[model samples]
Target: MTTVGFLYPGHFAEDEFPRMEVILDTTIRLVVNRTEPGEDDRRPDTLRTLGEPERLAAGVEELRRAGVESVVWASTGGSFVYGWEGAHGQTTALARAAGLPASSASLGFVQAVRALGAARVAVAATYPEEIARLFSEFLAAAGIDVVATHSGGVTTAAEAAAWGPDRLKELAVAADRPEADAVLLPDTALHTTAHICDLEELLAKPVLTANQVTVFEALRLARRRTWAPQLGTLFAAREAPPAPVGWRPAGE
Candidate 1:
């Protein structure tokens, strides 16, 4: 089985890893963020505080130990909350520290869009307005055009994670724009693998969600481009293999 990993940055609302495994019908290894001594509450602010390069590097190290073929920093805002440059460095540190292929949910979003040949996308964010705005900026930096965006003003990961498939469908349609080539739901806390195709059928456009793209990016990084179609159009993509990046062990 192809095993994937994620550096989860907060207390998740759902047991997301196992769900992805069931839907994708594969193995998913995960490393949740641990609080240091005297660490603050497990909230959005805490996720940001814990998103430092060294701290994230440590988490990736653990995922490597778990035998993850590929891993992603599976927190949307944590990956992009610091902006494009910072997130880039965070994934770079993860690759170097884990000596495994690494990607972030935020970076995965950008790459996913390009892979889908989508230039214009509408964003459905669970973050408050401020954090949602930063995601727009990060996408812009990646050269993807944001045709429209919406923020639900959600305050925490647990809250976003608690949303069921119905809510996920509602959010994606609400965020869709007539001009957008696709709709993006940028929250790793959310569970969308179950409803990705349903959302796409409703919107008649590609619907990319955090968990789906994170897995896709991990599979790509780990040399598992050949995937089954049940995950979503993102996985059903039968294009030629993405150019492979060289893999090196940590501490090279």
Candidate 2:
């Protein structure tokens, strides 16, 4: 079995990892290590602290012991709040600390967008508009265009975790634009594994959720793929292409 480690920020929605293990092919397994919950706020300052190198390093020992082939910082807000360059540095430091291939949910979204050959996407974010705008900027830096964005104005991870499938579908539908090739839900705190297929069908296009892309990125780093149609289009594909040469976050 191939194992992908995730350094999740808190208790919220970490259960999605285990749920994915059950839904995905038996050859792939997920090991999640919850890091310190610095604060529940989604503000940029709080998120920067949540994704700091020290906190990510503190969780590496557990994933290392689990024998994970790759590690990912699984919090979308935590990583994206730092901007593209800072997010790259975050994963680079985590890789050095864990001695394994490393990535984050923010970078995963960019990779997933490219993997699908999508140039423009719409964002359904659970963060406030200011923070959601930062995610758009991050995507822009990575060459993905954000055609539309619908911020849910939810300020805390705990609140976002409480959202259900109906709410998720509404957010996606509201954010989708005809020009966008796909819709992206960029909050790992939101539970989406169970509703990926449903959302994609509702939008009539590819729907990439934070937890889904996070796992995809980890597997890409490990040079592995699992056939899990229930996980959405990203996992249903035959294979995930390796990041392009000189990609800012090179795989180990």
Candidate 3:
């Protein structure tokens, strides 16, 4: 079985980790954020963002000790605000620390979009308009166009975590753009996987989310990239072969 390590906050969705099990039959080890004494809640208070270089480094060490074959940061806000270079640096650093392949939710979304041959994507987010614009720029760098964006101003990670699958489905319906080829629900904090099949049925197109695509890429790195019909349409792809086994980044 493949070992996929997740670095994320202590709070998570019930549907998030189980989707990986259904798709890959993989074991997930989570290295969660350790909060200070005053901060009991694992949720963010505001749009307030902070750098976590040291925490990520520690999480990498924890995953290495666990002997994980692949590691991924399950938080999108942590990686995305730093822009492309920040995300790239964090993934490279984690790969070196664990002596395994590493990626983040944002990068996984990019790779998934590219693999699906999608030129235009509709965005569904729980963030504000400014944060959505940041994600749009990141996707544009990878040659994917953001045809349309939708945000309901749902701030704080905890608020997103509390939103149920039915709400996520409704959001997808409202966010879908007729001109776009596919819809990307890019939030690891938000629960979207359980509604994947339902959303695809409603839209008659592909529906991808942060956690599902992150696991998909981790499976690819582990050389266990088999399609799972339950995960969504992206898994139905059959063209590309899995990467070489025991693949580590250069100079690691």
Note the clash tally of each candidate.
1, 0, 0
Minimal lDDT window, size 10, model 1: 243-252
Q: Per-prediction RMSD in angstroms?
A: 7.5, 5.6, 7.4
Between prediction 2 and prediction 3, the one with superior TM-score is 2
Q: Which regions in candidate 2 have their CA more than 4 angstroms from the true location?
A: 240-252
lDDT tens string, model 1, 1-252? Answer: 666677766556336556666656434343444323123233446656767777777666556667788778877777787778888888888888878888888999988888877768999987788778888989999999998788888886667778987888778878898888778998877877667767877877777888778777887787776554556667765683232123111112
Per-model TM-score, in order, reads 0.84, 0.94, 0.83
Model 1 whole-model lDDT (C-alpha atoms): 0.73
87 Cα displacement, candidate 3 (Å): 1.4
Between prediction 2 and prediction 3, the one with superior lDDT is: 2
**Best-matching candidate per lDDT:** 2
- Quantify all predictions' global Cα lDDT against the true fold: 0.73, 0.88, 0.68
Stretches of candidate 1 off by over 4 Å are 25-47, 240-252
lDDT by residue (tens digit), candidate 3, 48-95 = 133255566666776677667787776666677767887788788767
